[model samples]
Target chain A: EPEVTQTPSHQVTQMGQEVILRCVPISNHLYFYWYRQILGQKVEFLVSFYNNEISEKSEIFDDQFSVERPDGSNFTLKIRSTKLEDSAMYFCASRPDSNQPQHFGDGTRLSIL
Target chain B: AQTVTQSQPEMSVQEAETVTLSCTYDTSENNYYLFWYKQPPSRQMILVIRQEAYKQQNATENRFSVNFQKAAKSFSLKISDSQLGDTAMYFCAFMRLMNYGGSQGNLIFGKGTKLSVKP
Candidate 1:
């Protein structure tokens, strides 16, 4: 079965630097979402996108965070200034339709130094 | 606000045995969806099973099955004939159904129960 793929399985970035996490959602999927799980914690929603615009976002998705489907296949989440608290495993997910369950990517582990 | 709770932080079951992971949620919406996701050591999130609120019958997949009590807001996963490969972190999630034109929805996940299947 087709799956969502994420780039740079692990990323180490310096504090206050910019970092971008990339994901290629399943080809035919319509809705896209970004979630993060801090070590030993529950997964938390960051943002959801559809029709080329953000549909919803959690409070954790602050002004420093932004998402874009810069191209037809790639969905990227950019953090302008990384913080220690930003370190976590970021997962991208997509679903074909309303009734379908969201398929998740392997996840990108972001580590801030 | 909707919240998912997995009271058991960790559990263990012998190979070929059966184990059940508990989950409960607080939601006011009448229609919604519940799910179980497994995160193995590799840390990949994999969907295990899903239960729709409107469906009276529980959802099942192979050795995995759910006991969903809509009135009690409880959804638990049962693993029959468990194997060592079943060792993983299990997360229970909740999502409110949205209209067709709205976003599909984002998952609200529980803290997760770490299952250790001993051989």
Candidate 2:
């Protein structure tokens, strides 16, 4: 079965540095999303992207966060300034459309120091 | 706002036995979807099963089945003949049904229940 794939399975960055997490969603999928989970917390929604634009975002997806579908297959999440609290497992998910079940990637573990 | 709650933090079952994980959600929308995802030690989220709110028939996948109580806003997953491989963190999620006018479906996930199956 085709699955969502993310790059840099694990990422480590300085507190003030910028980092971009990349994902290649299933080729036919039309909707993409980003979610994060703190070490021992529930997975939290970050943002959703469709038609190359942001559809919705949460409070955690503030000024520092941005998502881009720079190409037909790549969906990327950029954090302008990484904070210690930003360290978490970031997941990329996609679905055929709004009514379909969203499929998740293995996740990228982001570590900030 | 929609929220998913999984009150059980941890549960254990003897190998080859059965287990059930509970989930509840707060959503006024009549149309939505509920799901159970399994995350193994690899930490990869895998969809176990899904249930559509409009469908009264419960969903079942092999040994994995669900008791979906639409009126009570509860969705529980039952794993029959549980095996050692079943040890993982299970998450319950909720998402609103997609509308025709370009609405995105975002999942609201519960905290997760850690299931350990012993031999």
The alpha-carbon RMSD values of the candidates against the true structure, listed in the order shown, are 1.0, 1.1
Per-residue accuracy of model 2 over B1-119 as CA lDDT, tens digit each: 99999999999999999999999999888888899999998999999999988899999999999999999999999999999999999999998865553346888999999999999
- What is the TM-score of candidate 2? 0.97
The 10 consecutive residues of candidate 2 chain B with the worst lDDT sum are B95-104
A15-37, model 1: which lDDT tens digit per residue? 99999999999999999999999
Give the Cα error of residue B20 in candidate 1, in Å. Answer: 0.5
The true-versus-predicted C-alpha distance at residue B41 of model 2, in Å, is 1.1
- By DockQ, the best candidate is 2
Question: Chain A vs. true chain A, TM-score per candidate?
Answer: 0.99, 0.98
Clashing pairs in 1: none
lDDT per residue (tens digit) for residues B1-119 in model 1: 99999999999999999999999999998888999999999999999999999899999999999999999999999999999999999999999986553335799999999999998
Task: For residues A6-112, write the lDDT of model 2, one tens digit per residue.
Answer: 99999999999999999999999999999999998899999998888898999989999999998798999999989999999999999996667888999999999
Ten-residue region with minimum lDDT total, candidate 1 chain A: A94-103
lDDT of 2 at A42: 91
TM-score, one value per model:
0.98, 0.97
DockQ of each: 0.68, 0.74
